[model samples]
Target: EAGVAQSPRYKIIEKRQSVAFWCNPISGHATLYWYQQILGQGPKLLIQFQNNGVVDDSQLPKDRFSAERLKGVDSTLKIQPAKLEDSAVYLCASSKGWGQIPGGSGNTIYFGEGSWLTVV
Candidate 1:
C-alpha cells in the first residue's frame, strides 16, 4: 500500500506570510492527523479527522492555523500569516479509528518525511 505523501520537503518564508501544506493519507485509513514538531521537541497534535469529521483539534492554533479533510481522503493545513514561531516540521499521519484508539499494527501512525517550514 502506498504510504502517506507530503510536499515541499522544505519551505522558507518571512514572518507573517501565509502558507499551506498538503497531505494524502494511505488508502483505507479511517483517521488522519496533523502534527507540528519544533526543533528538538516531540510532535504536537494539531488537528485530527475521522473521515470528513474532525474528531480532535484541541491543540490547533486557531488564531492562525486551519485545516480540512474535504473528501475524507486528502487534507490540507493552512497557516494564514505564518509567525516566526511557526517554523517546524509539519507531519501527516493516519490510523484506523474514531473510537478508543487501539495499539500495535492497527494504531500505526505512518509519518510522511515531513514538510519542513522555516520562518524568519
Candidate 2:
C-alpha cells in the first residue's frame, strides 16, 4: 500500500510567475483531489477528479489555476501569473472512491507530504 507522491517539495517564485506541481496517487485509487492550505487555515479543495473526468472545481481560481488527471492515474496542477496570496502548501490526496471503500463504511483519503509554494 503506497501513499500519494508529489514533486518539488518546495518552491519560491516572484509574483506573476508561473509554476506547476505533479501528483501520483496511491495505486488503484479512483479519486484524486488538489487542495490549497494557507498558513492558518484548513486545506481548501481546489479541484476534484473521478477517473479522467472532473467532479468539481467550483473553488478553483480558473483565471490562474488549472489541473488535469490523465488516464485517472496521474495529475498535474498549474498556476500561471501567480499572486502572492496564492502562496501555500499544495496538497494532493486520493481515495478508493466515493463511499466505495472495501469493507469500510466511509472513504479514507490519503495525502501526500505536500508541495510548498511561495509567491514573493
Candidate 3:
C-alpha cells in the first residue's frame, strides 16, 4: 500500500568522503532499481536487483559505488571515496518482476522525490 521510501532527502558532503543512502521499495514489489539523475538529465540506472540477486549493475560506477539488497526487500547504496561527478540525486524505484509474472514495456516505475546529494 505504501510507496517507496528514501532517506536523508538531502545530503551535502565534501568530495572523497563516504556516504550511504537507504531505500525501502513498495510492498509486494519483486523488482527494485537504483538510479542516479543529474540536473536536467534522465535518470540513469545504477543497479537493478531481482529479489536477493542482482540482475544488472552495468551502469553502476563500481569504482566508487556499491549496493545490496537483503531478504529481497530493503536496499542500500553506498558511495566510498565520493567524487565531484557523483553530485546528483539518488532515486529508488520498484516494479513487478518479469520472471515471477509477465510485465509489459508499458509498465511504468514509481520514483521517490529522490535523495539529493551535493559534493563540495
Candidate 4:
C-alpha cells in the first residue's frame, strides 16, 4: 500500500510569517491526524479528523494554527504569524479507524516523512 504523502519537506521562514503544508493520506483510510514534533520531543497531536469532520482539536493553537481535511482525503495545516517556537516537523498520519491500539492486530498508523519547518 502507498504511504502517506507530504510536501515541502523543508521550510525556513522569519518569525511572524506564514506557511502551509499539505498532506494526502493513504487511500481508504478514514482517520487522519496532524502532529507537531519538536526537536528531542515526541510528536504532539495537533488535530484529528474522521473523514471530513473534526474529531479532536483541543491541542491546536486556534489563534495561529489551523487545519482542514477536505472531502475526507487530503489535508492542509497552516501556521500564520509563525513563531520561533512553531519550528518543528509537521507529521501527517492515517489509520483505518479509531480506538485501535498501536502495534495491535491489523491496526497500524502510517506516517508521512513530515514537513520540516524552521522559524528564524
- Per-candidate Cα RMSD to the true structure, in Å, reads 2.0, 1.7, 2.0, 2.3
How close to the true structure is residue 44 of candidate 4, measured as C-alpha lDDT?
Answer: 97
lDDT (10s digit) by residue, model 1, range 79-98: 98999999999999987665
Give the least accurate 10-residue stretch of model 4, judged by summed lDDT: 99-108
Query: Among these predicted structures, which one has the highest TM-score?
Result: 2
For candidate 2, the C-alpha RMSD (Å) to the true structure equals 1.7
Higher TM-score: candidate 3 or 4? 4
lDDT of 1 at 21: 94
What are the lDDT figures for the candidates, one per model? 0.91, 0.95, 0.90, 0.95
Q: For residues 4-92, write the lDDT of model 4, one tens digit per residue.
A: 99999999999999999999999999999999999999999999999999999999999999999879999999999899999999999
Worst 10 residues of 3 by lDDT: 98-107
Candidate 4 deviant stretches above 4 angstroms: 100-106
- Candidates in order, TM-scores: namely 0.92, 0.95, 0.92, 0.93
TM-score of 4: 0.93
- Show the colliding residue pairs in model 4: none
Clashes of each: 0, 0, 0, 0
Q: Please estimate how well model 2 matches the true structure, expressed as its whole-model Cα lDDT.
A: 0.95
Candidate 3 yields a Cα-based lDDT of 0.90
Which of candidates 2 and 3 is the stronger one according to lDDT? 2
lDDT of 4 at 24: 95
